[model samples]
Target: MKEELLATFSNHFEKPLIDEIMEEGRLMEVPAGETIMDIGQYIRSMPLLLSGAIKVLREDEEGDELLLYYLEQGETCSVTMACCMGQTKSEIRAIAETDSRLVMVPVQKMEEWMAKYKGWRNYVFESYQNRLNELLQTVDSIAFKNLDQRLVDYLKKKVEVTNDNQIRNTHQEIAYDLHTSRVVVSRLLKKLEKMKKLELHRNYIQIVNL
Candidate 1:
């Protein structure tokens, strides 16, 4: 299990430093639909996802949940920033989208390791930089891309499990992720269906090559 955590950080650091960090880490199990972190909750640890997926979301003024992104295996939780910055609260919620196992390192321990290990410090810096880049790209996409283009791009990027190229997500869920409205998504999906680009089952949409 510790080796798995080290593997997740291998892209950013030397294997030896990762091994040292993993030595201080412990595995945590989260059930599906569980909130790992809540708004206003201070995180004392950083989680490295070892298996399954989690959703990072925020609530709007209307109390609607808006998806910031999904973290899968090999990805570390964004809560690392809040913990490291000594933030008293977090606006984002990390919810387990599936039953997940995570390697958790206490914030204080991680800080200590950074002071002791130059490689580990570099890895954390690089990880934060990469995360910032991803956030900036997401913001740029939302600012410039239309709903149709965003939907198409999302579909292309998402994994579909059905053999028929079908995606099983509700309009409200899709709207939340795209920062749009369900009505708009419904209209766009209908248009695509009419053009024979896809077929809509009861709750799933199947995209087919023309």
Candidate 2:
């Protein structure tokens, strides 16, 4: 576990620092569909994703959630860093998009590392920049794009993230992600099928192109 964890963190950290962090961290596996962080949960640790994928979503006061972005291999949840730094509660949710393995770094080390470790500091800043850009893009998609275009983009993104053309989710699930109703998603999907953009199966969507 240490060896693989070390290898996973290598892109952002040196061996010595990785070893130190490993001493303070514990590697854990998250199952598919499991929630890693929930709204209002205390920020105890930040996870370093080693394998598989995670979907980060933001919830509104109405308890409605919209997909913010994805964090897969070689990525960390930046919002967790914010909560860790300020001793605040989590404002977003993280769910395992696939069975994923990650190392949980205690919140104490997070602050100290930012002040003390160059690698850690660089990682935090990079994560913040990356996630903010993703969120901005999400906003742009929602505000400027039509529902069909957004649905098309969403399918392409799911394929890119999961490396699977066959998206194993129901129309209701897709609607939830898109913040629409099942009937609307079903209608658009039929339109996409007529356009030969994709093929729909029971509880799944197979993208033929785009």
Candidate 3:
């Protein structure tokens, strides 16, 4: 586990900090589609992704969800870090996008390490900046891009994160992520199919031109 931590995070964290993580962090496995954290929950630990992907989302009062960003291997959710630092409830939901392994670092250690380790502070700050940029990109897409174009971009990102051209998400699931009605998603997907950009199957969408 220590070796895994070092191999995945050594570039951003020092050996001593990694040693502490190995000692203090709890390793866990989360299956695909599992809700690891939900809105309004008090965050007790911060996750360090070891493998696979986790998608962070925000929900409206009506329960529609919007994809915020993905946490891939060697990445952590800055929103969760913020909740940890502030000792506040989570404002975003984190769901496993694929079967995943991660180390859950207790919230108490987060502050201790931030004050004790320069590398930890740098990692935290960089994560916040990266997440902010991603949020900006999402806002820009919603503000300027058409629904079809946003759907295409969303599909491309899913392919990149899973490293597969085939997306297993159902149309309704995709609708929820994009914060749209299933009918709208299906219509756009069909349009994309007719355009020869992708192929729609019973349970998955296969990327061709996209």
- Model 3's TM-score against the true structure: 0.98
> On residues 5-73, what C-alpha lDDT tens digit does candidate 3 reach at each position?
988999999999999998999999999999999999999999999999999999999888999989999
The C-alpha stretches of model 1 lying farther than 4 A from their native spots are 10-20, 160-166, 207-210
Extract clashing residue pairs from model 3.
Answer: none
By TM-score, the candidates rank as 3, 2, 1
From the highest lDDT down, the ranking of the candidates is: 3, 2, 1
RMSD of each: 3.1, 1.1, 0.8
Query: How much lDDT does candidate 1 score?
Result: 0.73
Comparison by lDDT, 2 against 3, better one: 3
lDDT for model 3 comes to 0.94
lDDT of each: 0.73, 0.88, 0.94
Candidate 2, residues 80-184, lDDT tens digits: the string is 888988899999889998899998999888888878789988988999999999989999999999999999988988898899999998998788788888999
User: Alpha carbon lDDT of residue 36, candidate 1?
Assistant: 88
RMSD of 1: 3.1
Q: After superposition, how far is residue 181 of candidate 3 from its true place, in Å?
A: 1.1
lDDT (Cα, 0-100) at 161 in candidate 1: 13
TM-score of 1: 0.81
Candidate with better lDDT, 1 vs 3: 3
